[model samples]
Target: MDYLQSLRMFVKVAELGSFTGAADQLRVSSAVATRSVASLEERLDARLLQRTTRSVTLTEAGRLFLDRVRTIVDDIDDVEGGLLAATGVPSGTLRIAVQGSIGARYLAKLLSAYTERYPLVVPQVIFSDGPISLVEGRFDAALTNDTYPHPGSVVARAFAHLEMMLVASPRFVPGIHGSAPLTDVDPLVLLSHDDGTAGVEPDPVRRWLDTNAAHATHIRANNSDMLRGMAIEGMGVALVPAVLVEDDLDDGSLVQVMPETPLPSMGLSVTYGSRRNLAPNVRALVDLLIEQSKSDQLPVALRHEDAALVAGD
Candidate 1:
């Protein structure tokens, strides 16, 4: 058995705390990963992990071994990465965590473009709306909304500036064309991930609700496409990414409401931990994102009717 390969697998299992998760990340089967770790343990004469149906954790000896092995593994990777960086041919599987499905459509396009440019690179994206630690989740990098609070440990760079706007069907909010106070809008659709009721940067919908002095929302969803769809169906007024509803506005199916009150543009960032040496594959991705972010063009526009498709994603 390759000792270095076993060490690499052990490190992943420790980081993710799941044999299955580590195996999936390494692109190997559970049995292969389990056997690799077991082989490592046998060589060391130390049990490195305590595995149960509920969780996988490091034993006392495992913890000590992990601390040393993690550093050794990182050093080896850095040496190999230095060569790859010099060659500029990023060849590896990049594990990425996406904040939510809100940007799924555009993210897919962006990754597609990235892969095309660097055929040697493979990106494995994990879609999650809730917060997941970059370290605990064992991610190479993360694409996140700007509002997501990061510890001082990570490096977050500009990814894209997504213009946001409030839109409604003329049938639902008759006062959309007129200068009516926000109170006239009966229902307000909200994006759940952006909720910051008590925090510094509140969700756009939360800001609107506070402005109108309302207590509740008509609809609250994590996906922007879903909110856009609600607005199109005349459910209520929704603040959504301009790119998602570009065609709707063009066709007049959805008209911009409250044009005077602008919604905050959702800023996206590519974040990675600062402690680790930037991997060549991760660096390549960040470089591409920065290049594309020059003109708010991270993703292509999608029709509002495609909301269901994006929601299911």
Candidate 2:
């Protein structure tokens, strides 16, 4: 028997003092309503209603059960109502993981606006050069490039593209000198991101180097900022995210090399545990990120252009 249905039928019948009246109000036939109440009484082994030819009334036991069941049904309604209302306004901490290079350069700018818009949401971020398990880390979502592997049970939404640019310190590769094909450079040392997390995709810079300059020496760092620093110090040429080095490029600290070589832009994606039962805060952040990526309001280094050949832009 459907216990809740039986309880509801009994309550309605008792209140209306007519089995037929309760059936009409509940949109069920009188026989089903009577059987539902009969099933309830048989299960409890207690008579809950006093029936008469003219009217129906509740017994003492029926009155007590009615009060408790009313509260139970009302509580269920309150919980459902509260959850529905919460879908519109997000609250609570929203933990996110981000790639180190993007985090250092542009994540903060995006988050500043997010905070202003959603003051109640507390955001915590984890910076990783490689992939991290979102579920294991207890992250609500992760911001990453398309090169990262998507874990099972996670859903990804691509928002923008990050261009990777080949850069060298002016002190190391001055103008008109470093513009040659990568193979022409002597004693070339390529700086790349070292693999840290399991199942990370191969670095595009390393792949480019292998095909173009098989003999170039390679230096690896687990973080992009370290690669940027090494490049700035004239240690070697590095393929760094454009967003992280916009100021350096403008200040003449770094120069873009081999501008003619076209490299595929990596897509920036947001990955969440699952689309099912997505929290309001996580949804809000993802929407904000998509909006920022499409508009001109993104960081200067992240702007997309049709003519530029560098990466990270």
Taking all chains together, each candidate's TM-score versus the true structure is 0.61, 0.65
Whole-model lDDT, model 1: 0.70
Q: Which stretches of candidate 1 lie over 4 Å from their true place?
A: 1-84, 175-209, 212-217, 295-313
Candidate 2 structure quality by residue, lDDT tens digits, 30-69: 9999999999999999999999899888899999888788
Residue pairs in clash, model 1: none
Candidate 2's displacement at residue 221, Å, is 0.9
Clashing pairs in 2: 163-311, 163-312, 163-313, 164-311, 164-312
Where does the lowest 10-residue lDDT sum fall in candidate 1?
A: 304-313
Q: How many backbone overlaps does candidate 2 show?
A: 5
Give the Cα error of residue 266 in candidate 1, in Å: 1.9
lDDT value, residue 172 of candidate 2: 77
